[model samples]
Target: MLAPSEVSPRSLHAVSPMSSPPSELTPRALVAGGLIGSVLAVTNVYMGLKTGFWESGCVLSSLLAFGGLSALARRGAPLSPLETNLSQTTAVSVGAMPASAGLLGAVPALTFLGTQPPGWAVALWGVGLGTLGVLFAFSLRRRLLEEEALPFPTGAATAELISTLHSTGSAYAARARGLWVSGLASVVLTWLRDARGLVPAASLLPSTVRVGGIGADGLLLGIGWNPMLLGIGVLVGPQAGLSILLGSLVAWVGLAPGLVRGGLVQGADFASLSSWLLWPGVGLMAGAAATSLVSQVRALPAALGDLRRLGEHGEGWESTAGQWASRAVFAAILLTLGMAWFAFHLSPLYFLLALVLAFPLCAVCARATGQSDIAPISPVGQLSQGGFGMVAPGQPGLNVAAAAVVSGAASHTSASLWSLQSGRLLGASASRQLFVQLSGLLLGAAVAVPTYFLLVSVHGLGSQALPVPTGLQFKAVAELTSHGLNGMPPSSTLATGLAFTLGVLLSVGARGKLARWLPSAAAMGIGFVVPAYYAVTLCLGALVAVVVGRLRPSATQTVQSAGAGLIVGESLLGVLIAALLALGFLQPPG
Candidate 1:
């Protein structure tokens, strides 16, 4: 890693504007960005709905947009470095737009509510919430990116890639080619497992392997080909990867078998196992993340002070261009409140409470995202649900949906900042980048809202085939808060408490002396909710990353880069496959 430069605090830009000649944010750049962002929005939505997590689009979008735009430039296009920045900024912003309200966390929870609003309402919510996220984040650009110099890793990476592309385009071709190969391989692997149906899955196993009443399939012990899971594991690094594996063992070997043998759980199917197990996983993760987030509250005063000072000085917050930005933030939020109250028939009082909680939560999400690329959005969503479960009791729809208002904002705000960071590094126009970001969000919503319904039609929400894990967690929290432990078995409740405590201890310990050895509490907790097969694949990927890092540290970046390619390729292919399935052009193997 390059050492931190002792850049002056007044240097708001990551790269000097005079470092190289600035290029136009051309019409071609805007269109390419919108198109790329739309495609990535579809891909990430598809991937996230399936896995309950998503890779950041900035790096992938930067690489792809630069290459594609550069190729066009060689022929007839007039793309410039700043234009590539504009394109990437737009792509990352809009591509993840739907995630603010529709894809990952909130809309899917509506499936569990069993009474969803019409599609158009949801589409509008995506746009409004997404825009609010950008507005909310724009105000903090100076505080977080400029004054704090927080390492938005993915943002930095994307910026570095853009800088590389602009300085010398030929050097990028090798990395791009490697990315393509991994992506193609990932698509083929997914096809073989799911569509081509090459892999044989058997429930029965020999006596030695089958312990208690749990069979091999019951434990989900067999490996399944999912390149995306593996790639994600590699990106997360070894500690997190190993933690995931450890969590998988805790579930499949101990929890799954024990539940079956003790007659606590009724079935061995994926849905049956995951539904019961999700509670503890959700709790563990939420509890740990909540503790960590609350601790950051201590630093808020200093950060806020810095922000105020910047505004006072006119060098940071107060600006000729972004001065009226705060007004826009208020307007967008007010519009969001109105939309929530009228369109969805949400209680104005209850929705307002959610809105009040959103700003701080959004800040925390940004802090977490800046520090580590992992945004603990699911846990934060649960935190919102738990808070409001009592505030708006027994109203599952309001509970999940209202929380979405904040979690969505928090999540997308950090996402937009990631894009802005890239823009900063490339010396792109901040105001114009903001404009493209908002525009990309609109484009993402247009594409993503429709894709969501298509996926729902093909796989059906809440099904094992396309389990929206984040939504399920939200649904579970809503139910748990409203019902308490009345519906659950005593053992289940006890187990959940134990897991939660374990999560607390682990996280707190990590914060203290045990920081180095222990795995990420969040990753470990996630293993409890997802299918064991996913954990296995993730572990495999992590294992590969670890081995390579140990044996050949220099090539680790190359491998990780390739892994990223695999993620993008598989996601795009997955979207295509899902589309074909929805259209009845491709029959999923019966």
Candidate 2:
């Protein structure tokens, strides 16, 4: 029996007070929750295509899904932490997956399949990759959750949103209204700017905007003033986001123009520059992962010890339902993997190699990121599929790519489970959370797959066709495949390296005085790898965050909610407009 002090409801204002946890969600509530989850998922996916990790958008989506669910649950039945976790997990998964669309993995799948892979293939891949990710993440959750107390800043934000909405009904209503209004307005402006290609008056601002520079067809490249993104820049603060912006300006505005003027680079030069950005991004991710793993090594023994204790407790952590669900998802994934292999006629040995490599890689990466719960099994999926470009050479098809997808999905599943386990520790019911999570996974996968196809068919992939501003995606791939680090102009690389070293020193040295600048290491590292434009954008976001935080002394939760609302609203609207353009419901302005 849990102690009353441990589990009883305290004051309503208490962050995690146990007032029946928020009531079990009603059927109506579930449907609404799912729909909201779907929207959030879609929006985040779209944003993810722009920013690696989908960042604040997905975080916000999770918050909204949880907050809305909690609010509705008050009227009917209260939801357990398990249920809430499941819903949030599913929604997050949906958004994350779609972001991977049209990348190397999805591209091969589409090119080879000539259409979307069968439902079974997608399901199998999804389940396999998700599960593997979760398992890998499980190994590290104790370390990340307990020892480090890594502020899952986003998760904390979600919890606070739920608490606030529940405690003050009037405030909740007002915020919701504001969100909708802002969202709608953003949607309209995005559609006009992106789909219709309207030349806004802001474009005429000589200092703030530039119009008609050279682009693909010798047509003038039109640039418009983006106050929203600029506002986001302000919120992200001057440090990180501004750094990214400076990098972007240097690459796109400074270097690109210089090259063009000198006749040293041309249309094709853009591709080469993109390659430069990508490798740095890859290196940064790898380094970050490596660093995280090294930091958490001490906690490994304790985590493993917990597993031993769990075993001694006669599988106390295991629920029959959870086991069954896990098995079912696993079986489904296996069957799909088999079918995909059969369809592609892949070498069984290669397929097995890819499948086997996924788990260890995911586990290692997960441990490193302190996200041991989401062990990143899918990155292996990316690796395997990308490797297939070499393994199969000429045969770029669904068979190889689907294998990677399976690996990715398994990783994702493991991550979700880790998240669920965290909820359990915090006093959530297991069964309810598991069920909601499973439901969410299914729903997210179903919606996201179609959305991926829709987006790619309409917008075309990569920076040239899509509005996703250039970043590490193209840059890293280019560096790995085309130019090695040696390709970086010696002076540029030295400058970046020096800056990076200084960033590290500053971060390490200014522990108390400039704590907020720590994330700038990531920015510097990312800046080194990607174009100056993307670095600038990130810096912009960081700046925006800092300014807003200072200006509004309100709780962090309220500010994050507003920021999240802006991100989701703008991103979703962009997608809808993209879809309309693809369907010929709208046309680009001449």
Candidate 3:
């Protein structure tokens, strides 16, 4: 049924036809990517822990790399498009370490379960799992990216941005200036609020609102003075942002009071409410993600065909898996299984089962991300947990660890494919990008592993400051699997079931034109887990973007750059604040 046009080799180079290979994989590009990735590694750990959302560093990294490299190029060698892609790819790889390392979810869930994994164990586990995912990307690049012609919107956007930046001399400088100006402004605002105590945590809101006998503070309703959330709102657009807002209002304003009156929630604080709300939230996310994955079943055979023909093409490492690529993949499997055996004490059976399941799950993740820009990372982990719960039974630790491996691999697979999508458009060497991405993985683990521990030590997991909502979902799933709803409130169980059904229905309805008008179940689920203020700010950010676009369409990208700067600026500042608190230079907020 496949068309000859789809399988033609020339289609691979349709975007960029070069007479000679460009200057890619340079030491400067690698170093630039490594350094930027180190910062992103730290930034993402802070952002992921606090908000349960991590930004892709590609666009921001592209601008930064271009700005820096272009500056130096004026006096020396010129920068090439492929070289910039390599740098951005490397930076994204490093920045994505927090998720791949399980710091955002599973590993933190372990700590909550009273098992603190050593830094070395966590690092090794991340590298092994991430390497497996990267190998999957390597194997499927030609098929998914070249043959299938998946949109990969993020990659296309990045590629377009790169071409635009390089085409005009001043374009990069202008965007870079906007990025840094907004970033520096965010840094200043964060310092004023967090460090110097000059700004209130929530700027524009009433202190409290009383519903019946329950008094709700603006902060409790999730209104806060955080630019990062607003920035996220801008990036995600109106549909998701508004969905989150609706979810927040429904969860906090509508549900919290009823729970308080029912004596289900003992207090109006975030911790008290989220403990009960997370059940329904987690259920909704699970249902929607499950539905989404099932929708991709039709593509499995094609994905498998690609997997089967991974090394058959004789186009070297770019289009085919040559001897070196095959050896590396085998090595990656060994490293992953070895880490599973040594670090988590997972038996070969469980590890291999997870490995087998990961291919389909990661394939679904990649395709889903390409089609809809949603990676389903959390859903992938929960699915793993459910599988292991049945197989292992009564071993919550094993369930959590197994889920961690699957999610970690999925995360890396998604990230790798995104980079490869851009590379294909730029005619960059897939082999070289793979090498750079792998290097970023190592560098990120090295820098971010320590930073994760430091932030946890200072902020404390499950605290109001670092709620680690994603981790709580993982923890909730593991516990539920072990105990089977023993001691759960009857009301909470009813709510969870209803929410799950609703999520499934919404997901089923979110196809084609209806998708734009429908509420995003995943965003609603996230809104239920995180504080309400994040939703409010995210909506506001989206509003700003919408208004700006209508006023001047040309300024849309500038707004996005500014929003990205806001996120990066505040995230890096949060990390710095954590370090200061750890070193006793700054006191914890009273």
| Top TM-score model | 3
Model 3, CA-based lDDT: 0.80
- Scored by lDDT, model 1 comes in at 0.73
Query: Which model, 1 or 3, shows the larger TM-score?
Result: 3
TM-scores of the candidates in the order shown = 0.91, 0.71, 0.93
Candidate 2 lDDT, 457-493, residue by residue in tens? 7765444333333223333332333333455542345
lDDT (tens digit, per residue) of candidate 1 on 273-295: 77678777776776686677666
Please identify model 1 stretches exceeding 4 Å from their true place.
2-21, 76-79, 168-171, 199-208, 302-320, 371-374
Off by over 4 Å in 2: 1-26, 55-63, 66-86, 99-124, 134-153, 170-178, 199-239, 257-264, 268-317, 325-333, 339-348, 364-422, 464-541
Clashing pairs in 1: none
By lDDT, rank the candidates, best first.
3, 1, 2
**lDDT to native, each model:** 0.73, 0.47, 0.80
How many residue pairs of model 2 clash at the backbone? 72
**What is the Å distance of residue 52 in model 3 from its true position?**
1.7
**Candidate 1 similarity to native, TM-score:** 0.91
Model 3 per-residue lDDT tens digits across residues 1-590: 12223333233234345545568889889888888888788878887887788866778888889887887788878788877889999998988888998999988888888777789988978887777778777777766777677777787777777777878867776677667888999999899888888877764344555755566573365457888877888888998899888877888888888888888888767788888888888777777877876788887887677667755544545544444666677787788788778767678898889887787788878888877667888887888888888888777777888888889988988888888887777667788888887878898899889989988888789876787878988888887776677756548888888888989988898876688899988888888887777778888989999999899997777888888888888888988887897788998665
Sorted by TM-score (best first), the order is 3, 1, 2
